[model samples]
Target: MWTDVTLKQILLITDGCSNVGTDPVYVAQTAREQGVTVSVIGILDDGALGEQGQREAENIAQAGGGMCRIVRTIDLSHTMQMVTQRTMQLTLQQVVNKELRQIMGEDSDALPPDVRTKVARMVESGTEEVDLQVALVVDVSASMTSKMPSVREAIRDLEFGLLARGGTHRLVVVTYPGPSGEDAQVLRFEGTSVADAVGALRAAGNTPTGPALFLAVRALRDLGESPATSSVRANPEDREEGRMRHYVV
Candidate 1:
C-alpha cells in the first residue's frame, strides 16, 4: 500500500561496456512504471558512437530519454572518484524529485494529462547515471511460508531485470511476517547492497508491520538521506499507512 508520489531523476554514468545502453533503457522503462527518471553521463568515454566519446554519451543520454553530458577527468583515479561523488549527488537529486512539491503538492486536484506524464517521464529518464536503489518489501508470515519461494523467485526476477538493465541498480529487500507465532524478524535492512540485501530475506516470520516499515525506512536512511527520502520513507507526514502493503499467494 505504500504509494510513492516522489519520482527520481537518474544520471547514468557509463563506460560503454557490455551493458552500455541496455542498463539505462531498462531503468527508464521499469522506473517509469513506478514513476522514476533516468539520465546518462559518459565518463571513461570509450565507445564507437563518436569521436572523443561524444557520440557514446549522446546515445546513452538519448537511450535513457535524457540529456547526456560527457566529463573529461584526468585519469582512472580521478575518474573513479568523480563517478562515485557524482553518482551519490545525482542519486540525492532523484530522491528529491520524488517527494518535492516543486511541481505541485499532493493537494492538487488533478494535473493536466500530458503535462503530468511529461513531468513523470522526465524524472524517470535519469535512472541510469546514479546508483539505483530498489527496495522490495514482502509479507511473509507462517501462513505464507509455503509461498515464500515464489515470492523470492519474483524478487529474484526483479534483480535479474535490474541487472539486465545494468548500471548500479542496488536492490534492498525485506519481508514482513504475519501475526502467527513464528513471523517476527528482520528480512533485510536498508542500505544493504543488492547482493547482501537479497541474502537476508529468509522466509520465516510474522508480519510486524510497524517495525517492518520502520526497518525499511532505517535501511534506506542508513545509506544517506536522499531527496526521495521524504516521499519514500515510513513517514506519516509523507505516506498513509496502507500505501505500502502487498498480498501474494
Candidate 2:
C-alpha cells in the first residue's frame, strides 16, 4: 500500500475580492502543477457576495485543480471539512484516471459501469486512509473583521474533526497582508492548538490572495521535503514506486 502519500491541500478562506498583487488563479495553477490541490471557501457577507467575488473564488479553485464552495460563517466549519475531503477524493481520482490511461489506455469515465463503480469506491477509501497536510491561506482583509471570531472557532472545529480521522495529519495557517507589512505570514500552531498565531490576527490591509497563496505553496513544498514527512517523494525510487503503489498503476 502507498501509505506514505501525504495528501497536500491549500484551503483559501476568503470573504471578498482580491484587490492586490498578481491574479490568484494563475498562482493556483502553478501550485496544482506541483501536485498540490488548492480549494477555496468563500465566507458570505450579509448572505451575499458580489458576482465578481464569486467568479474569482470559483476560478481560483478550478485553476488549482480542486473544489470551491460559498458558505455562511456559520457553515464555514462544516464546509471546510467537506471541501477538504471531497478535494482529496478528487485528487486521488485524477491520479487514478491517469493511471488507467497509462496502463489500460482508457479513462475512468470511459470505463464500464462496474469498473467505474469500483474505481470510485477505491478513491473514497483513499480519502479515509491517506495522511493529510493542509494549509489555510486565510484572508485577514479589512472586510473580514466581524467574521474573525467565527472564523477562529471554525478553524478549531476543523482541527478537532481532522484529529478524529483514521489517518495522521498536520495543519498550517497562513494569513495575508500581515500586520507589519508582510505579504503573507505562516503562523505556527504550537501544541496542536492555533491559539497564539490566530489570536494575533488583525483584519486589516488589502486582500493579497495571490501572494499569500504563493507563500503557503512554497512553505508546503519545503515541508514535504523534511525528514519528518512520511511522503513517498522523499526519494527518487520511492517517488516512482509511489505512482505504482498509490494507484496500483
Candidate 3:
C-alpha cells in the first residue's frame, strides 16, 4: 500500500438503509486500519433515511475516523466539497506537526496551538503539492432513483471545485450493485467529464455497500501499488514529501 501518501478518504453517499451484504460499519473499520478515512453523507430527502439509517451512517464515520452528516439532496454538492477540503486541511496539519517535531525537537511543544495551526496552513499552502486520487462511491439502490439527477449535478460541482483548487487529481466513479450485478461498477473517465458519466447512472438493485467499499478499497490500494507510485516513492526527492489518496463514495 502507499503508506507514504498524505491522506486517504472514502466518501459514502446514500439515501436509505443498508439491507444486504456485510456490515458497512465493520468494513469501515477495516478500511481505517488500512489507512483509508471513511466519511458518510446520508441524503434525507422524502424522509427515506430513518433513525436506524442515521445511526449506521454515524457509526461508520466514527469507526472510519471521519465525520458524518445528514443533508438534503440540494446541499449534497456543497457538503461534499466542504468535507473533502476539510479533510485535506487536517491531513496537511498532521504533516506540518510532524515536520515541526523534526525541526524543533523537544521545543516544538512551546508553540501555541493557534500559532501552530496558522503556520501549518501557510506551510501547506506553499510546500505541500499533492497527487490526489479519489474513488467516488455512490449508492444506486432503488430508493435513490429520484435523486440521481441532483447527484449527477453534485458530482459536477465537486469536479469543478477540485479544479479550482489547482492540483493533480484522478477521480473514478463507482456505483453499488452495478449494471451487470457486479458488486460495483468502476468507471474511469478519459477525455470526457465526470458529469457526463454520472448522467448515465441508472439507479436500481440492492445496496451492497460493504462489498462496494471493499472493491473501492482494493482499487485505491492497487493505485498505491502501481508502477508510477513505486517510481515516485523510490525517488529520494519525492520520498521526503507526501501525496494524497482518497476513496469517496
Candidate 4:
C-alpha cells in the first residue's frame, strides 16, 4: 500500500519495552528501503522495564540505520507528538534535496569533450545543463514482460526530464536477454544524447545484469579517455594539468 505513495521522512516511536523485540528496526528498515529516512524515540520511565526498554530502543535504532532519542515523559501523548514533528521536519529537508537533484541531476565536475561538443550548440542556444554518461541499466527478463509498459514509461519520463535540463547529458542504455541453457547474449547501447538513446531502446531480452554491467563499465572506461571526456571535465584547470575525474554513477 505504501509503495504507491511517496514519503520523505518516517519516524517510529517505541516505548523501549522488553516485549518489543526488533519490530522498530524492522519497520524503520522497510521505510528507508523505500527512500525514507527513519528516526526513533525511546520512551523511558514507562515502568520498571524502562531501562531495559531504553537499551533495546537504542539497539533497534542502530540496527535500523537511524538516530534515536530517549524520551522521559509522564504523558506518552505529548512525547509522541514531539517525535512526529521532528520526523516531519527531517523529511521536508529530504524533499528539498530531491528537488535540487531533479533540477540539476547531481553536480559533476565537467562535461567530457564528446558530450560537450554535442551540447555545445544547445548550450550556445541557451540550454540549462546536462548529465554526463548517464546509463539506465534495466533487468528485462521473462518475468518482467508484463510490466514492460510501466518500465518503458518510467524510462521515457526520465529521458524527457534529462533533456529538458538541456546542458549536454549523454545517455547509454542496455538490456539483458535471459540465459539459454548455459549461454547468454548481450545487448550494448551506444552513448548519445538522451533523445536518440531512448528512441532506440526496446525491451525483448533476458535480464543478464552481471555481464551487461561489465560491458557498461568497459565502454565507459574507453570513452573516459576520449576528447569528449576532456571537454566535459569539471574544470579546465584540471584538464590542463592532465587530471581526470572518474565518476561511478
Scored by TM-score, the top model is 2
User: How does candidate 3 score on lDDT?
Assistant: 0.72
The sequence of per-residue lDDT tens digits that candidate 3 reaches over residues 15-118 is: 87777888988989999899887889999988458999999899988987877989999899999998877766665555555666676652324687865554
Query: What lDDT tens digits, residue by residue, belong to model 4 across residues 160-220?
Result: 5444542344444444442442112233445533334334434343323334433433444
Candidates sorted by lDDT, best first:
2, 3, 4, 1
- lDDT over C-alpha atoms for residue 29 of model 4: 56
lDDT of 2 by residue, 1-249 (tens): 436568899999998888889889999999999989989999886623578889999999999988989988889889988888788888888878888889899988999998788788667556666788898998887788888888888888887767766566777889988888878898866564774468668878878899999999988887777654332222233344444355453
- For candidate 1, give the lDDT of residue 24: 29
lDDT tens per residue, model 1, 3-76: 32222333333333211113324434544444333344444323222453456456544543445555532242
RMSD versus native structure for model 2: 5.0
Distance from true position, residue 26, model 3, in Å?
Answer: 1.6
> lDDT of all predictions, in order shown?
0.39, 0.81, 0.72, 0.40
In model 2, the runs with Cα more than 4 Å from the true position are 47-49, 227-249
- State how far residue 173 of model 2 sits from its true place (Å): 0.6
Q: What TM-scores do the predictions have? A: 0.37, 0.86, 0.79, 0.33
Rank ordering of all candidates by TM-score, starting from the highest: 2, 3, 1, 4
Clashes of each: 40, 0, 8, 18
Query: Candidate 1 vs candidate 3: which has greater lDDT?
Result: 3
Q: Whose TM-score is higher: candidate 1's or candidate 2's? A: 2
